[model samples]
Target: MSPRFQCKQRGAIGLMAVGVLAVVLAFTLLVVDTGRLYLEKRKLQGVADTAALEAVSRNGTCLAGLSAATYAGQSVARNHFVVGNGNTLVTQCGAVTTAASGQRTFSANPALSSAIQVVASKTVTTSVAGGIWSLFSGNSVSLNTVLTATAVAAKPTPTLAQLSIKSTLASVDTANASLLNGLFSGFLGGNVSLTVAGWNGLLNTNISLLSYLDQLAINLGVSAGNYTQLLSTNVTASQLVQAAITVLTANGATADVLTALGNLKVAAISQAPLTLGKILQLQTGTTAAALNANLQVFQLIQGVVQLSSNQSAASATLPVSVLGLANITTQIKVIEPPQLSAIGDPALAVANPLGPNAIYVRTAQVRTQVTVSLPVLNSLSGLTTAVNNLVGPLTPVLSGLLSLNLVTTINSTLCLLGAGCQQLDLLVLPGNLPLNIVLDAGGASSYVTAYSCPTGSAGTKSVTAHTTTSLASLNVGNITHAFSSTQPMSVAPMPLVDLGIQTCHKILGIGSCDPRVPFGAGGIAIQVQSNIAGSNSIQDLVFSSTTPFATPPNVGLASTYQAAAPATNLVSGLSTALNGVSITAYQPSGGNPLGALAPTVVALLGSVSAIVTPVVDNLLAPLLNPILNNLLNMLGISLANVNVGANLTCGQTGEAYLVI
Candidate 1:
């Protein structure tokens, strides 16, 4: 019983041992082969990633001479991944598009190469498990299998471009300084006093945009390097000024400039909160390095102050005085704030320079209204005498043109008594009359229309911008209501004179005359309305290496609106307006009383135009021309000309990162 049982148990134990050995060998091969494949895959993935990143970082393109494939091959070689030795590396150029939901998609485009894609593959022996299956099934399966790894890399930041708009005012004089002070004071709702030197310092000084933003971020307690948030954040005018002061102080600005800035800061306290994005526009995904451009201190301050003013209820009052006029009040309001500088992707801007998403900048749009109280004719003995001498001879002619019995009736009825006689008096311009002159200046605008960065040299970089100069309109009349920044101002005929009667009462043996009463109901109101057309034009601004981001170049754009042939005869428009004076006759209630006297009134106006034109020209030319020109210059607005500046940096080489 024992011998046969022992023999069977030994055989069974040997069979079990052989089976366990085979299973252990198979499991070991599977583990080793799988681990080797995994390691190879990992290595291949590393090579592909490195190749893609190198291709993009080197600015590789699919265009003719330098190809992304060539760059990727070099990177693969450096990584020790040999090609054609059971290993292959393929590269393709493409662009990365990001959706609004933050989803990224890659599209292969040979024409555009914003990103590079690399595929690395190696042919390796089939897995042990498959080999075993093939052996069991008696089928001839392939020995080698392809293992591929793919990677896509692109520039972390986009191609950045910056444009700056500067004021045409290169230097400041005492007169300009005074005007600037009055303007800024009016905008800030406080007093702003700066000397000519101080203003000139601001105009000449330049501030680094990056440094200013950095300091501003720090002051605002925003996270470092978060320029997008900093730009969109709401900040007070004082904060913006202080940030500029800090940057200027670090750059060692003149004491006068700093002091002036300090004064401006104090004045800016009354201003409302505003975002820097209004004045300085930065497109989405703009890199921090692109903000290294420079900005003029005057332009920056002016833009910020203008933005503040646009949001505030305050209006600027210009300190100007015209001869022969009393209570001269001038008010200026900003209709739209200026976009002083912009940084963005040139590719996006190229589609439409003035589109909502494009990189564009513009000067402030402003409206200036001047109200002048006409001199009291009776009070001014000399002016009254002069006016009487000029218009007294035309009274009989005016009576004939009016077709009224004003002279006869007054001579017969009033002079019949000779005790309390009433006399008809001809007043050219009555007292407490207002003469309003409104000037609306549309600011200039500039935007990047096209740009190119040559593959090889940075010197050949070129950027083009389309600029449109300002268009302005002028109106001379009487406006009853206050000026508005948002709504358009309407002009009504300005009352120039009153043809009326004066009644005298016998008192203490002396003839005393009451205030002059208008004829018919009161008097005839002679009003004049004048309008001047605005001129604007479009031009191209080409920037080259000479106008780099460090130093911007300015170009003056002359308006297409020709001001007479001589160009200096700006008063010719006034003359034209005065030539077309319209005489209006009003009855006691409302309607015009003179039904058929329009043609006669026109003839009368022709006669009176010669005399009134000179007086008006003399009175207004000296007063309005200087004020308008000086105000326009200081406000960065012009009817005849505009100054625009431009700066462009194609893009900087940034770190490459995987996008897909």
Candidate 2:
């Protein structure tokens, strides 16, 4: 090549190299700055994400009570990225927004507190890019680029479960039409005049929690997701009646049930949604809500009727007549609160803020009374006369007689512990007739606690209870019987008896008779008594559950259960003071006196040995003992057959949920 051309070519090559270098520098600055932006953006995103999550977790619900959530969020963001600490800068500190439907929105409204959103920005300075730009332009443009990152997070709203009863009216006592009618009327808002068949219809229907909730949602014309709206809706009395009719109609209830529901009254103008807590409170005569307002009025009415039916079945009245000598009747009742009768409280499984060691349970109480009436011994005197005629002048004891009656009432309270409850499932609470009983008699009482354990066999459990009662002073009042005015007599004291004496005496031209002593007696009264209090037990109160345990989102199978100690000493220090009992002469204070009669009278008086023998052994003992034993037995109730209903894990109140 020529030297001149080669020099020109070299200069051109140098110029091309300079141009290429300039392009490379521009590309390098762009790439470096872009990379810095990305890294800073990622860091800011991390800060926002951490802050948002922490904030939401701290304040699941946006409320004034949990104002610390904002502080926690800002602290977390500052820790991750803060101005003067690095390239990080939180342009908007403590800024929270709700993100839903792929959009982040902010408003000064309380309803949008479902989500927490954090926005963070960072400024990344570039030295190399600025220097390179300055070299070419002889001035530097702003190389600090601001990058922002945002994050949204929220927790899901917690759900609660209302109990669903799966029981039949067969467990209820329908024998007493009055009791059944009254209970039905009270719960149904008026007298529906339910017949046995109608009661059967109500009792046979067992509803599932989910199905009921769905039906309620449908009736409310809302989706299941709109639980808050459903809960907030006011339910009128007419609406409640209509809802029941709708549910029953949908479930193919009997005609009688439909008619009965149709007949319900619309007295309550408007009411809030029924809740389990409210049901329990109502049973206890209170109108307070115990659980979340997740149930409608129809559901509450259904629960009320179910429990009332069961209780009705548990109560009974029977008429008893003992050979016309005594007529007695008995009334028995089993009482249980509706809520505790169905599903136990979840709070009970953990702890009762009200008190410690307060064993919560689904309970049933038993109360029974026996009314006894006995006429005066006037009728019983016939037996004495008959016996005297058969024994030829061996007249049985006789004494003062009058009308007598008695009222014996016994009350018992029992509870079923450790019940299984599930959310959104049918709950068939065990029909343990009676588990543990607290027996109260007069002023004395005893408590019996039952221990039940699940057996190895599926769906089987056992219960055993023990208690002792030693009543010393049981005030069984004095009894009296009347005889004819001319021939008054009593089996309680001794009548005249002959001692094989050939010498007979006649008084006032009457028939001859040997002297007989009357034992001291008004009536036989047991002042103080002591006996062993026996134990009562029932086995295999088997309860089969299709939905006993629960999974996540619902509280799992509860490991915590309440247990209590039974009363060991039932009735101690019983002091009895029996009255109207003594052996005395039945003859008048003054009578015919003679030298031979004196010895005979003394000998007859010595016959106090046989005084109580015939009177007690033949008449009173046989009739009275059995009655007393039966009365005692009626005071005790044994429970078996336990069933578990639906379970509910009501999350803490004011729990927030993610809406985005």
Candidate 3:
């Protein structure tokens, strides 16, 4: 029993040990293969993630020269991932689109480079369990498995962009300086006195936009680096001027500029509060560094003052003397304030430039009414004498046209006593008359329409914008109603001269009579209305640097806009109006004094035209042209021309991250 039992037990023990050893060996092989596969997958995933991030951060594009795949391959090589021979790395350029429900999807586009996607795969030996099964099955089977990883990354939406709108008044001479002083002084509701040199200094000075915003934030007690809040804050004109002073002083502005700014600041003390956002538009998510552009001091100050005036209740009044023969008074009201500059993300603007959130800028809309008082009409005696001489010779013709014997009427009235009577004297124009001219300038506007970032070192960066110059209207006539800011002026023919009869009594060669009176039926009036057409066009504002926001340049491209043919010429307008002179007739309170002469009076208009035209031209050529032109030039309101400036900052590099 001992020998047989011992032998059987030993054999059973050896068999059990063999089976246990086989199970342990299989389990160990499974564990080792699993670990190997996991490590390979982890390495592949790392390569894909890093490659995607690197490609996006490098600003790689799918455009012609530098492609996203090229950048991703370099990154994979740097990460020690070999491609080819059963190991593959695929890169794609695309964009990540967000749906209304906030779901995101990646769309591959060879033309788009907003995002980068990478797929990395490696072929390795199959798991130990599969090889063991294949050996037992006695049939040749595949022994390799593929592991793949995918990753997508992109930079944040909305690269930075900037735009500026400039005034056409580039320089200031003595005449312009005086006009500026009067205009700004009236806008501020205070006296602004600056020398020509001081005005020119202000015009030539440049202020850093960043520094100005920084100083403004400090002045308003806003936290640093909060440009968005700073721009939207409402600050008085005095505060804006003070911030400009601080920035200019820090930037070493000239003494004359400083003095001029000081004077302006004092004048702006009583001005109302205005939002800087109204004048300078900054889009959401704009970084402080993106605002590193420059602005002309004069432009800044002018924008602020105009904005303040637009919100106020008072209108600016400027008194001017034209040709020393007429005293002209101009009342200017800003219907809408100007958008002097703007900075933003071009992506949003490209979608819809005229949309509510678009980065659009426009010049100011102004209504200027010029009232001319001819207190010195007596000084235009030459014109009056010419008109009298011309009409005196036509008195006989006028008798036939007027259906009345003017010579006989004068004799019957003044020679009642049978004494010699003086001839009938006709005065062309009265001693004093008031004339009014109104001009409505609906300034120009510009907005971003498209943009592109640099794809390579030699790639050009640019921003395209659509510009529209608005139409301007000029009215030269008599306005019976008060001027309105929102409504168009109702212009009627201005009474230039009144054709009437003068009665006198002569006694012993002495004359005693009633003064000449206006005709009860007929008078002369001048009416002129002209519309200056504008233009619409597209412009490209190029950027010199790839990363403009990093350190913005001081200046940018400037575009000048001009109206269509027959630019704004006040004298020309008046002259054209004079050519179209109208004769009006009205009945007296009782009845028509001329009875049947009304028709004849209207017929006399044709003959009077020839005489009135030359006299009016003679008066206007010498008295109105030079003065009106000088006044309009000083106001910087050319119905014909405008200027706009633009700057662009695509975005900064090295800001890419995993988005999906």
Candidate 4:
């Protein structure tokens, strides 16, 4: 080749060689640099994970939050490559700390951010082909080459979330529901909860169950706010109901107990859980539970109340007058102490003394000793003075729940207010009262009149009570025979069993017109014959007196009640009411009153309205207003709707009230 042309060709060859060298160098560097970067990243990431897990395990609550951030930083920086180059580069990194949130969001701190990072420097060197070729042109053996490389290693935003935040919320919702169901079942005496298994142990591993229970009672007022939110959890209606029941039971609320129960039943009936098995299980369980669990599905009660519409029952716009507010379902201890605001009418013992009741002075400074042998109470009553408080609506249907054995265990004295009495049927024979009483005075067991029944007229009997008493010996004999001449048994089934009117024979539970006892929308005409001169005793009874079942032709409403009134002895007034179907008298058997019904006084009271006050004339006492009483009784209404001074005082001494 020519010298000049040869030189140009050689230059081209060398240029091509240099380009190839550059290409190979770039490929090699790419592998080494990327690999180094990856390794460094892994190291930093592992550090973050370690520290974060430590903090989490420790539950750094004060900074359960702040520790998360610290952990992330610590993890990201734990490993590093200080490139011999004074320059240090960290691109991205991240770390996790907390387990979960109220929303079930579990992740390390800055969940999506890089927690650590590091970078390396760069350098380049010439290739063998370039150095050799340059040796021939100049005295130089090789040529210098420069290359730059930069490495960026960092944890990137998480493509995968450790935990979904929404999941946390879902979990909380579930847990809360379980807590609720568990509490409710426990309160109502149901089987121990499967969820709150150990909770049934009746002992808080952390504290005494009683202490917890007491604390719950105290904090209930405050915790109500926390619990109220639980009610609004985004769950099905049935689930919500279950939670509500649990919370209320755990809290031991008095007023809201029934209300919560009723609500649960209602939710069960309406929007049941979507889970079919759960729904069926709940239904069956509730059915079984209600047999023993009387926490009262207040929700169902509300439903029943809701059943009332703008309609009339026999022309009377129905006012939902539940007999009592407090019921027997709750234990008596759960009955909050009475406040004066609870007092109302019917303060006397008569006219259904158990209801429309009033509190009278029992033997204060009383000894707790029951018999000389066994005492009913543990400690003596230091009742030198009492702070009278009236309260109650807890009636038999809900309150006085009998034990499975049909036995009632009571260590405390029963105290009720006038409002309580208004709900009780006192005039009923034997009364709606679930107790027996015995009065004592005048050196003998006496039946002193505490007060006459509001709805009933007072009847007199010739009672001869002895006044002489002995200290060593208690004169506890029949005191009725002292007043007039021959005392006869006073309380019979008529005014005692139920406050109503009936035919003389019907009240006596025999020889009545209807061959069978009748109930529901029926009437009776009771009678009394003052056969006191020779007759000895008279009695009456009150029963369901249900009407006889019959075919369509015989289907009719019958006042399913039977009552009677009879008199003898020094009885005063005698008359019939219910258009002359029933009778009333003052005395039992024996003596007779000296005069007719009191006229002047009767004129003032205006026709005596189902009741006749005797003119000092004891005979007329029995025969007062019979018709008006039956009419009132027929209505199945009480004097509560109207305003009146109703006072019913029940006094029981030894042998005061005897049930045969």
Candidate 5:
């Protein structure tokens, strides 16, 4: 052969080899792309699952975990290729408006009582593969996919838990619905009970109504001395009665009587009363007439304290038999709030201006709460109906997935969805198609709240309710207590907000100010808070100012949580565990899911008075009731079981007694 002929033969062989290599390269690229698409789909499903769970959790809502997950998924999808979609082609990412980071959304119908619905979609394009594929196939290759998942999750119920209220309280106290069973049936103790009624279904920020009560307790410690002094000097029990009677008999014209009554130094009195007890300090100057009048005054005080002055005063006519007390005037000012506002400057007052010495006492309070257990009364009752109803709507779609062996994958994806997916993808080339996702969920629960008043020292019957509010920004876990201001803090109040995403709470620390908050009402005084640090609790906040000194909160958490301390003197340190309520949760047989949880929480509390509050009958009974019985016995006052039908007198005006 000639040289030219040999050269031509070599060229032909080279062309054939190049063509063969091209085919191999194409096949390899297809396999690699297929594997990548599979991996992307799995990863997208995971991101979607995580997003849904975060959305379902209460903390995630606050921390915006779902949104974060969506953002993360979008960022990841940017690395995938966009393939031209076809009937047989699979998607890597779902049909998304844009492949931007975090802008997509997945949501469940809150209206559904049971199931969690999720819809996740994103658009991804292979930056390299599409151009190369276009060069060879004369077509652009991109990936587009839509993914959705749904879950019928069990609601989180706070029932079924064995609760223990380690308190000295006599009965269950349902102060706020988030903390009690109200029936007392769930409670276990020597003789603990509960009274659930009239719940304020509003709990925002750290201060539920019950939490507000404890906060007030701290404030009380600050102003207790001044109020005690005010009690002693303002007017003696007898003096007040005499002044009122004098004004009454004179047809409400005796200004001098009014002035004298108002001017009487509460500092001079040693005892006062609710029904039978005298909350005053009688001296040698205390006369027989004064004592007699004091008894009447005590009766009036009881009526004034117990009844909610929040409403119009009742005009009941008690038959005037044995110096009856009637038509007592009452007034009240409350700092009750549902949620603390953060729109204004952080330095404005959130509570009424309080004096360092002139503390406000809980005159009378009736708190109640309800805790609906998990898997409560009828958790599964409507299940059959709901499932049957879904059959018609889901049949066609489910049949398709099953026929294509999609059940294992699609159904699994559905189960994986916790609440709602924020991001999900199948990694298919860019395509335009509508995906339908439908979900329905249902659940049941019971919730209740209950409360009692602060009992006072020396047998006083007071059910006092006092509360105040301040402004602060709370993150996922922590909370800050600033002065009476409405400004946003430089930092998040809770750790969850600061921690980025996906975290649980260890403690719901209630706060009115920072821990190092200055005591007293000098500059929105910060009382040393409990459930966090040191203790300096006193026996009772209601005490005589001149008796001695060592302010608490000079207040303490002694008013909120408690445990029996017979072995240790609780009054000595800030460790007086004497609060009255506890909570527990129950789960339906299936699982624990918060949204489905109705009365998920069961709170245990004590309302029966013994010896803590001090408004006598107004704000406290535990302390006031005992004192009343003891004092009346000492003073020769007695109960009359005169069951004269409608015109009956059970006991003394302010005294509590069994009318047999």
Candidate 6:
């Protein structure tokens, strides 16, 4: 009885031991399988990261607008897990986007087109868990675990490194509102009015060049391709205006840009990169930079145009004596025509400069008309009663009023058709009394050249271009004066003023007596002529990019602007036009009684001319020169001294990074 019971107990104990061993073996197999799956997943992640990086490192360009980077990434991921089954991989040239539903999605956005996304998946077949599940459930189960890995990478590029600014000399003068108004009206095809503060706001504002590009890219719905994208996008005038407005507002600018912005139509399309660097005209480098600044060439031009267009015509009243008689008031007016286009191209020279500026400004043509009235009847009225006291009896004499009118005008044009050239003309005319007088001055032609430096340093500065003003021409009535291109301005026989006189003899017992007067000594003439004949030279100014400022108002890259020394001869010529003035009195040959009074008349007229000289030489000439100079300065083609402004630097290599 004991032996049988002992055997049964031993069998039962053995079965329990075998069953526990099987369970331990199964658990070990499951652990090993789970570890293998984890290891493979980690390996896949590494492969995906490496593949994405490799794809981005290669040029992203592909045929048919397809992403070569995508194919490259897929090939790399597949190579890394060639031994795995159910292997799947996908690569795309896009970035991850999140939806409102908390889901992640990849979309083809141009801004993120440079990035590469690589995803890889592999299936791991189960060894023990699959069998156990099948045995228990009596059905085939997929013990195949799927592992996925994803990565994103981008390529490196080059960008702007530093910036310098060229110096500039600018002044504000609203006295010539007519000229401003005309110019503005022509540009906008309508009237505009801007206050001094408004003009200052535009002129004083600065923008970040790099930031501007980024804004433009955003507006155009394109990606900022390390600044290269600027070359591919074309913005219309209105679009450009909007983009500029964005920059100005972003910088908290206070300029009144709405008028110009609203007036701008689709007259032109502006390209980037070259257009941005058009003023500097750098021959080397890709012209693609991420340099940021407060102001740029185009922005400055736009500001100026907007400011001018928003102003009304210029007008003013001045008082002056006429022929040393009664004081009279004179009115002056100046008008400026609007420009059709003022855009620019970086690839063009100063004349062409990639493309023509949006607006082409011309010299303001000034027209002046002067009228003089004399009180001849008042003097005769008192003397009429005293006629009987003289040796001869006189009758009641009739008195007549006399008036004189004179007109003068000046005009000029420069740099037409992107030729970087200039030309000018002037004309003057005296009233229709019995004398003819005329005065004219100005050059026939002028050419300009522009310059730039690679590093934007001082020593690298040079004459980017040069200009040649053709021989100047001067004329006075019948006389013609010519000046060579190399000679200073000079004109001969510049007839200035002329007057006619008459005399009459009284007869006794008659109501009125009249006598004929010869046309000889009774006339007055004044003129100025120049003898100096030599060529003149005028220098144009150019500016360079400037360093950034640390303050709020000037917190941007500035430029160093250097103006060419103005040709002293131009000033000298102006002085010459006013110098060498002379007054002349001619003698009569006929039996005219007025001949006897020529000497006394000459003395009186000489004194009158002397007074007029101060008004013309000191007041008119001085005032006119500054106005013309201002016009030239506003054109940005010439400068009187060196000026510096905020600017941004460019031309440096840059690396890309993973955004996600």
Give the number of the best model, judged by TM-score: 1
The residue ranges of model 5 lying beyond 4 angstroms of the native Cα positions read 1-40, 46-73, 81-660
Write candidate 5's Cα lDDT for 1-660 as tens digits: 999999999999999999999988987887787677666666655544443333333112111222323432343345342223421111111111112574533222221211122334444445346557665897755554343322212123111100011111122223322122211111111111212221111010011211221222233332211222232333223343333434333444234333323322221132323211122222221111111111122223222222211121221111222111122111111112111100110011112212221112211111111111223211324422322332233235434544433332211222123332111111110121111110000000001111112235333211111221111111111122211124432212110001001112223463232222111101000011122011111121122222232111101111222211121231222122122111112222233221122221111101111211111112112222321222111111211100000000011123111110
Summed over model 3, clashes come to 0
Residue 155 of model 4 has an lDDT of 23
Clash statistics: count for each candidate: 3, 43, 0, 124, 171, 79
Deviation from native of the Cα of residue 555 in model 4, angstroms: 56
Candidates arranged by lDDT, highest first: 1, 3, 6, 2, 4, 5
TM-score of 4: 0.21
- List runs of model 1 lying over 4 Å from the truth: 1-157, 223-229, 320-327, 376-428, 455-460, 485-487, 500-535, 544-599, 638-640, 651-660
TM-score of 1: 0.63
Which order, best to worst by TM-score? 1, 3, 6, 2, 4, 5
Compute the lDDT of residue 566 as modeled in candidate 6.
Answer: 40
Model 4 is weakest, by summed lDDT over 10 consecutive residues, at 159-168
Q: How much lDDT does candidate 1 score?
A: 0.70
Per-residue lDDT for 1-660 in model 6, tens only? 699999999999999999999888878878897778778888888877777776666645322344555655565647666634687767676544446797756554343445677777887776566667677998776667678888776654332222232213232346433343343444444444555444444455556654566677777776554344453444443455567677767666643544433434332222211133222222232322223244543334443343233232333323342112233333222223212111122223354533332112222222222222223211333222321121111001100101112111112222223222222121112232211112221221111234334553443322232322222222222222121223443323322322222232234544332232223323434454442222234443333323233211111234333323443465566566555445555454465332444555455554545544544455335333533354333433232332222122222235545544
Tens-digit lDDT string for candidate 4 (1-660): 789999999999999999999998876876665565555445534443444443333322212244433543344346442234432332222222323463322222222221222222323244555555577778576343432222212221111100000000111123333433432332222321233222222111111211222233233332211222222223333443344445555656444343534434443433312211110111110111011111112222211211210010111111111111122111100001101001112122223333333211100010000011012111113210110000111123223333322221121211222211111111221222211111111110111123221123443211111111100101111122211223542322122112121221223344333222221111111232221221112221212112242100100111111111212321121222112212222221122111111222223222222332221122222122221122111111111111101111222223111010
Worst 10-residue lDDT window, candidate 3? 555-564
Which candidate, 2 or 4, would have the higher TM-score against the true structure? 2
Alpha carbon lDDT of each predicted model: 0.70, 0.36, 0.67, 0.23, 0.23, 0.40
Runs in model 4 lying further than 4 Å from the true structure: 1-7, 26-36, 59-660
RMSD of 3: 15.4
**Per-residue lDDT for 478-516 in model 3, tens only?**
764434545665787666555554556666688776665
For model 1, how does the per-residue alpha-carbon lDDT over 31-131 read when each residue is reduced to its tens digit?
99998889989999999999999998887877667678999999999988889978888888766767879998877755446688999999999998878
Report the C-alpha displacement of residue 233, candidate 5, in angstroms. 38
